[model samples]
Target: MIQMIKKLLVIFLALAITSCKTQKATESKDSSQPNVLVFYVDDLRAELGCYGSETAITPNIDKLASDGVMFNKAYTQQAICAPSRMSTLTGLRPETLGVYSIFTPLRKVHKDVVSMPQLFNENGYKTVSIGKVYHHSSDDKKEWSVYYGKEANTYNDPKNIAIIEQLKKEGKNPKGPAFDSADVSDEAYKDGRAAKYAIETLEKLKDDKFLMFVGLSKPHLPFNAPKKYWDLYDKSKFKIPSRKKPEGVYRLSLTKWGELKGYHGIPKEGDLDDDLTRDLIHGYHASVSYIDAQIGKVMQTLEDLDLRKNTMIVFMSDHGYKIGEYGAWCKHSNMEIDTRVPLIISRETNYKKRKAGKTSDALVENVDIFSTLVDVCDLKFAPVSDGKSLIPVIDNPQQKWDEAAYSVYARGKKIMGVTTTDGNWRYTEWRNSNTHEILGAELYEHKNSLLSYENVSGKGNYKSVEQRMKKLLEIKFPSNGEPFLQNDK
Candidate 1:
């Protein structure tokens, strides 16, 4: 009887251990799954006070950065709006996907390519987008489970149409209103409406499990905002960037690239006089502050709805924009200000309780966003993805990652360009599409020349450094006999 009792006890112990293991595995999987909210901004640079900028007042964004892991050297795979957005959504390099310009829609690339929202939706997450998540207004409807706002901005409102007609009569720039703080109304602006709609949806879907995309369109073009926001910044307090032009800097004309001239309007070199420059800076700052206020509203709503503890918030821009940096006022350039954007990720409290107010200098790219979201949500993903999950970095900020960030721009079928950065060295090369002729080359060492005013591409001092960077670029990009040579002409 004692021997029989011993055998039964041993068997019961074994079964208990197996059951415990199964329960632990199930809990681990559940802990990894978290709701995601991507707060995407348009044409925003790393100019916030949190990212070492002293002037711009972005309180809400700064708060988000302080409470999460801030990526100090994050880059967009492309500088343009459409290509950059497409790259982030698809987790593929712009060059590899053959989407190097804004004219082409994402549908043209791969009809069945899984986007971030689509992937999440397939994995049992309710995906929805508010405002301008995608490039065009028309494409947003098809990409999201729900879309808010008009298909496109009413550019031809009777008041604006009259202004355009008058400008045409005078042979002046017929774009829109010049830089004016008090002239615009928030209701007329698309961004304000976007914010309103996003808040409403957040309130309506307070209890639903969702992956919500909140897109903010501000500080992009027209630089339009309420006068109150403009009043927040003193014009005299603004200072222009001190970066100088390189000796052989080749300014690629906008027409050649088939892109917009400037983010707002092409103000001539002398058009933005001292007063105008200060006003422009004020307008830009006001727009940022205005956006920050709107973000605050949304954040407050989330907290009030008791969803903050469960939702994972990610705040980032499609790509950076230049506000008088390098004598430029828009994106589409290969400069650091145009390519490097602000990336902040705020995980829910249940995810291992990361150190609050910590910053990570990890070199990350926009493509990583897709895999990060997937891993955070414990969702299944395809084996072949160009981006790696940022889970390791989020859990341990000091994690090591051996990789470089790359961005590409294609003006035409015959014109293609590429940019790569390894946290310190930045290299840009442009080539003709048909003849494969080298058009332009730019190289800058961030440690030595943070502003990138000094081009050390062919200089004797950096010969070895340039060679090493070139090899890394080739290994990553792998040009197929398309003449990957550098040209400074």
Candidate 2:
């Protein structure tokens, strides 16, 4: 009887071993379904070495551009963190969600929304989010299989931390200086910690089909980075952008850049001095470089683990940032500077080794990211998204694409500004939110320039262009029924 029991145990153990090996092989052999590595940077504008930036030191990002299809005309649906990110993740427009504030809960607004990450999670991909994938760590709890959050405080300097703490204690506004360059390690900051977490997660997910989103919080607010990155540039060589608003732009089109003003050193009203402007610009460049270095580390890991060939990598910013552009300190308007963003997509041997290291001038928006990913992964049964797939453009950058990219801005829930651009002309129309009555309009010709310094909307020569844009806006966002109108796909 004892011998029979031992023999039965041996057989059972062998079966369990075989089952475990079979499961592991199945998980790792899903080569048809490529793993996805997304580097989602915050407040990163199109100012990298690949984007013809003259001064920004972004070697890692530039290399990614070299290995991928770079989109020169990528724009965000909305120029804020939460709304823009939500639009990309859900393939839904901001008007569809009607969420503009960072504090608003996403699930409350769209209960049944299938986010991009959630879809991947449901599709057997190990979806992981590190750092600030969403505006808040708690924003989309159900979307990620694993989430690693960073500390709220972005400052490493003890002085700045003290100032913020004291202000909070006294029932006062708590914000540190606009920029801080501290002599410390990269891990001393939030972006660095995020990079470390990403590297560790990548190693764990190498044997599994996974979707990892690593968010870097830098080049955003309170430009805080290590001293080494700040030392890369000389502040004197940094060119300060125009400090004046567009000549014919309405007062409603611009904000006081209250976001910048909330910092300790920035003034509540009035123009900043040349020294301060240069310092702020310097800090921004440093933060960008810091992020680039971290990206290099993560990319190196992807290569070391032999996962680069099978991973579809995407590098993008949530939205653009305005550093002294048009005297603007932040992104809250429909200005071209605030709307255009940096986007790059790269994969090796995936989808039959399509074109690489190419640049696409085709107009694209944040919503299209979801559509493109779905198409690349061949997720046919996934819920239909609001965006048109950019695979046509990615496969062929010069192909005839969408007419124009659309973006919108809400002014205190009272006024709504809708804008569009067709690579040649940009137009904006402000309207009463509730009544949908057009209040004002501004147009800029971008044939020779991208600066919105002059509004030649009603100019005799551009009358036809202005009229065309108006019609397009109506087609894009109709005044009847649901405001969540989609692009004619």
Candidate 3:
């Protein structure tokens, strides 16, 4: 009878051990999954105070960077608004999607391409978008479970028009000024309305596992902001970007200027008086500050609702804008100022247990955002995505990562190409795939020439370097069954 009792006790102990292991595994899985918030901005660059810009006073964004991981060298797949947004959401290159211009519909390219929001929604998350998440006017309602606001704001809406008319009667033009100024307050802009809506959404969706995309449309164009934000900066202290335009560089035609507005050329020497430049700087700084304030509002709401501990926040721009840099006013160039953007990721408490407040120097692209979200959520995805999951680097910043980012732009009927940091050198080459003609080639030794004014492409000393880069380009993107170049004229 005693021997029988001993065997029964052993069996009971074995069952208890197995039960404990199963409970721990279930807890681990629960802790690993986290809610996601993507705060996407338009036409923003790495010009924040945290990124070493002395002029712009972005306290909130700087705080976000301080509290999270700030990427030093993040890039967009393309510099344009629509294509960049498309690449970011789909994890596919613009070339791969055949979406090179704003005129093309994304659905036309691939009706069945899985977007980031769709992926999240399929995995039991309520995915919602507030304001300009995809290209304005592009039919993308199918991607989100709930989409709020118009393509660019409701300016065209009759109600918004009526509101603007009332403000006009009170001696205020909804459109602030000819140039952007930072002297204005956030209350005067549409982004403020968008921010308020996002906060309300967060408050409403408190109990659901959600993927919230808050898109802020500010500091993009018409550079208009309230007068108080402009007052924050001393106009006398503002200085324009130091890079000069290359002589004999091709200029866009009149038709192109009409499409993109006055962003191609520098004001002829002394054309922009000190006051104008300062005002422009003030407007941009104010717009950034305004956006920063809106972001803070959303963050505070999440914290107040006790969602911060389980939510992962990502802040990034669709692409960098020139803001009068390199003698250019807007983005379209393969230059660093136009391509390099700020990217920050704040890990959730569970993910933070393994990777929190850690900065990774690994080169990342906008396309990677799709895979990163999937991996972070512990969801299974198809085997073929153009981007790699950044979870490994998030856990171990010192891990070796070997990949280079690429950006493409179509001018007329031909596409221009750019490849990111090959070691210390950044190379840009433009070729017409149909005509096989090399339009332009620029090679910058980023270690020595960060501003990229000194092009060493023609210099004999960099011949081997240029050759190697050209070879890499050819290997990565073979001629598309056509000639190497075309007549873009």
Candidate 4:
């Protein structure tokens, strides 16, 4: 008995010693995991300096694109904000989310889904959402370790507040025009406050592996920007787009200008005049510059905390903005200008293949973000996705990819569906949910006109092209009006 006891005691001590060494090694590996920072912007399209914009003051954004892999053919799954955000976060399409508008929450419709940040949380990374990561905070409360959300009133000047109050007292709403260029400081805006929060969080999370989402709400509506950004542009340098209705396009494809009509100076029912149109364009450019500066601040903080080297950064907009394109004021259509967005992904020095300063024109979708992050971070999740991983394209930007991208826009069950970049063309079909009949159809040759200002689906010359595009859509989506990922296909 004494001999047996002595042998057991010796084995126990050896096992304990091995366990301590293993624990220490595991802790060291966990601490060295790369941080993730996603800078989500509102209503920013593919109009940055790196994307060949002549008037956009986006030096910092341009620099980010230059240092990262910029996706030239990135498209949002939906043009609407709430649905688009839900799709991107959950790695699901709008149809799968069952949400078509900002009024609906994803949690109500899809309870079993796991969001992008939530996946980081599960992986032992401290997840932090600084501002507007989701359309609503309640969309996914399980995701963030910390969240900072505030009302979007960036124009906090005392004088502007008084003017707004006076207007409210006079029974007049305070939505003064579709744009506001106040001669105030940048910090006076809500986005500036959000940036401050992001900077502070970066400092606190510098020592740990963290996933931070900083969303800036600008260039969305009211085009509100500090006067400094506005002064950067000369009105004479702006050119107003053609406001005429596109030839051969259905009226169903046009927005009724619901958002723009709520503002003060816009016409009740007509296209904006040249001068008003110029200011709106000018205001959008200023807002873009204004938000770009805020992004610069957050990025600088990342560098100050020395987190840049080990951080995997993703900068993207939720959806594309119309900004007077096609005489459209907002994103409520299936147009390429509305569905396409700007997406840039930057990996740290230690990442494989290091496609770090490259650009990929491969067709990609917003929902692919979830899977690509998982691929880069090596995350494993049980949930399936409609989005495919973009790791192949990241490893080789010249790799052949899916020939098309998909997007959905609906005004209550009346769906406008599309499969774009099919041989440099976009094909759209509008269907009535109650009746399985096709209500409308559109086809645009993007190579002929980068902006599909003219619709050619009705033309006899493009009849076969239309058929081919329609068949592509049918193969990807089911005819039963509900959307599900057919992975085997």
Candidate 5:
């Protein structure tokens, strides 16, 4: 009986060993696949050192760009937060999803739409969302296996908040010049905490397949940053942009410049004065530096874990911001300043093949991010993407590109503007939503000249250019209620 029991024990142990070996083999195969790490920022424009910004103190981002494909002319589908994010995550345009403003949630429009993270999740990836991946916190709940939450908030010292409140009692909005340079630890801000949590998550998921997305919220509003970063830039050296509302443009194409007005010390009624503009620009630069530090934290963790070779890092902003450009303060226009953003795709292959640090002047859109990742990770399942895959350009920086980018911004049934960029030119038309009447049209030449500073649409010298671009615009963005556009295909 004892000998029989021993033989049975040996058989059981053999079975257990076989099972363990099978599981280990599977894990080893899965681990060989490249991981995706996305660093999505809010309101970051094409102003990094990699993009030729002499003023930005972005070392980590510059390094990432050095080891990645830096897109020189990347634009967003929409300049606003919700619409841009919707188009980016769903791989569809805002018009197709009916997401034009921040009022609507993505699920309310397309509840089961496969998001970028959701696609990865379905493909056996342990998807993670660190912060503000979508504009609304709970819009796409099914996408993430680990949702770190959009725990983004504007935090200020109690003394500042109290002063603002006291001023509010006197009918003053009490914005402290639209900025704060508090002498505090990086942990005092939400972005710092985001980086910390992201680093910890990287350590936890080091052995597994992960799509770890870390969203950094900074340089958005009130331009809050730690004093250490604020000290990086000298306020006296700040230069106000050459203020020029695109000439020959329709009057309706101009906005009332409303974003920064909510601040306590901001002018309640007009564009910022020279002094205020200088200070605001300085604040924005400080905020950029602050966010750069947080990025360095997670990237260092990634490198320390020796995960660089088996990981792909994507760094991008939802849309670009107008930092006093065209005297515009925020991102709500069809101008290049608002539409053009920074996009860097860093693959381990680029580093290994000695083909990294290449810049592509290819006109790319934010929506293309979905397809690009799908192609990179070889994801089995994916939603039909409105944007095209950028892997071709990634493989060869000198490849021929579309030289085109499209964007739109609409305000209710009152007015809507659809913009199209071809090569060095941008053409935008504002139309009355109720009657489909043209309110205004603008055309700006960007090659070897001031970008968007002058509108040549009304000039006879560019009549043919305008006519051709108008035709391209109509073809790219068809009339509403028509077959949805899939031009990238």
Candidate 6:
């Protein structure tokens, strides 16, 4: 009996040792996978030095583009923050998710949808979020393994802070100065703190597989940055754009610049004084340079830790922002300036195929980012996404791509405008939601004009182009007048 007991004990010990080895091997396999680092910026227009903006000083972003492939014609699914971000992270369109407002949380509508971060987390990668990845803090809490979300304020000046406090005491939302050039350290601003968080997180996760999202809130409203960044540009060099609305544009296509009007010094009505306009533009340029410096710090940390070679890095914005274009100060329309964004994707493995430092004019959308990352990382998810993988275009920028990029804007629940652009012509049709009857249509040519200054729908020469764009929109998104749900997937 004693001999038999000894033999069974030996067999049990052997099985335990084998189990330990298997677990170690699995961990090793996961850590061998490439890491993902996303630099998500807010309200950044494609007007950087990399995008041929001669006046903007953005050496960090320019360097990144030189090391990666820059998409010249990237468009967002929507031109607002919450919906645009939701669409990109979910790999679904705004209509599919039924999320058009920031108040609507992600899981509120699509409880079962697998977000991009969640996919990586479930696949054995540690996911981290620093700063403002989502529009709301409570959104997709389960998606991140670690979340450091300390938001910064709009103004750092003592007087502006006092004003904001008084407004809060009066039970009203506070509105501070339109722009602030505080003589403070870089860490005194939002993007600076976010960069520090990202760098620290990188140090902690150097030995493991991680999907790190570093969000930078800059070039947004209340343009505030360190005074050092403010000194990077000449105030006289910035030009205020045209204040006129496009001829024949639907009246509903524009807003009264209400977002900027609420600031402390802005007039409630009428055009901004030319001096104030130049100063606002200067503040914006300073904010961009400030964020660019923050990005540089994070990128330096990645290199110091030897994470760059094994990491897939993507630099993108939530959506484009309109700066004094057509008298619009914010993004809330289907115009090209609002929908177009900057996208740069870089991976060391891309160097094997000579894919680095190139420009792709292929029309791409923000939704395509989700699938592209998945494909590049060799990750797999069960559900098919709405976005097409841009790996093909990345491999060969000259390759033929989809006909156009699409965007939609809802003017309340009653009217919706759907637009399509192919870099040559942009076409839109506003329709009644229930009946899908066309209420208004717009067509703008991009062949010669920098800005779409007029609507030429049904014009003598552009009729065929308008019809083609309309058919493309109809085929891709049929007007069923129903909330598109994932169950329809």
The most accurate candidate by TM-score is: 6
Worst 10 residues of 5 by lDDT: 480-489
Taking all chains together, the TM-score of candidate 6 against the true structure is: 0.91
The predicted structure with the larger TM-score, 1 or 5, is 5
lDDT of each: 0.72, 0.84, 0.69, 0.79, 0.80, 0.83
Cα distance off (Å), candidate 2, residue 340? 0.7
Angstrom error at residue 236, model 2: 1.1
Full candidate order by lDDT, most accurate first = 2, 6, 5, 4, 1, 3
Worst 10 residues of 3 by lDDT: 252-261
Please list the residue runs of candidate 2 whose C-alpha ends up more than 4 Å from where it truly belongs after superposition.
1-31, 165-171, 479-489
Cα lDDT, model 5, residue 32: 56
lDDT of candidate 4 over 1-489, digit per residue (tens): 999999999999999987775665456348567888898998898899988888898998888887789998899988878888988888988766667778777777666788887777766678887767788768746668988864565554466566677778899988655666677777777787889898888888788888888888888887888889999999887988877677888768878868888876678887878898888889899999999999899888888888888898899999888777777787877887888899998887577677767898798999998888777777644268889888889778888998788887775655545445563788887776544467778888776434866788878888898888877787766456554322110
Assess every candidate by TM-score: 0.84, 0.90, 0.81, 0.89, 0.88, 0.91
* Winner on TM-score (3 vs 6): 6
Clashes of 2: 0
| Residue 131, model 6, lDDT | 84
Model 1: per-residue lDDT, tens digit, 1-489? 999999999999999987775565455344535677888998888888888888999899888888888888889887888878877888877765666666677776577788887776555556778777888665566766677734343342456567767888998767665443444556556666777777788777666667888888777766677777878777888887653565556555122221234323444343345666676678778888878888888888888888888889999999987666665567777767678899989888666766557787788989988888777777654435688898788777777775677776665566666678888998876767545466876778786433667778888998888877777677765545554322211
Error of 2 at 30 (Å): 4.3
- Steric collisions counted per model: 2, 0, 24, 2, 4, 0
How much is 102 displaced in model 4, in angstroms?
1.1
Give the clash count for model 3.
Answer: 24
State residue 3's C-alpha deviation in candidate 5, in Å.
55
What does candidate 3's lDDT look like per residue over 1-489, in tens digits?
A: 999999999999999987775665455344546889999998898888888788888887887777677777678887778878888888887767766676666776567888887776656677888877887545557777778754332233344456567767887545423343333346456788778888888888888788988888877765556556666777777886654664334343001222124332224343355565566667678778778889989888988999988898899998887655554566776666677788988777555446545566677778888888878877544435788787777667667775555666666575456455654676776777466466777777766433566667767999998887667666556545454232111
Better of 2 and 6 by TM-score: 6
Looking at model 4, the pairs that clash are 154-189, 154-190
lDDT by residue (237-332, candidate 6, tens digit) is 888888888899987887777878888778888888778889988988999999999999999998999988888888999988877878768788
Q: For model 2, state the Cα shift of residue 214 in Å.
A: 0.9
Model 1 spans > 4 angstroms off: 1-32, 149-174, 183-188, 250-271, 381-383, 432-440, 448-450, 479-489
TM-score of 1: 0.84
Query: Scored by Cα lDDT, where does model 4 land?
Result: 0.79
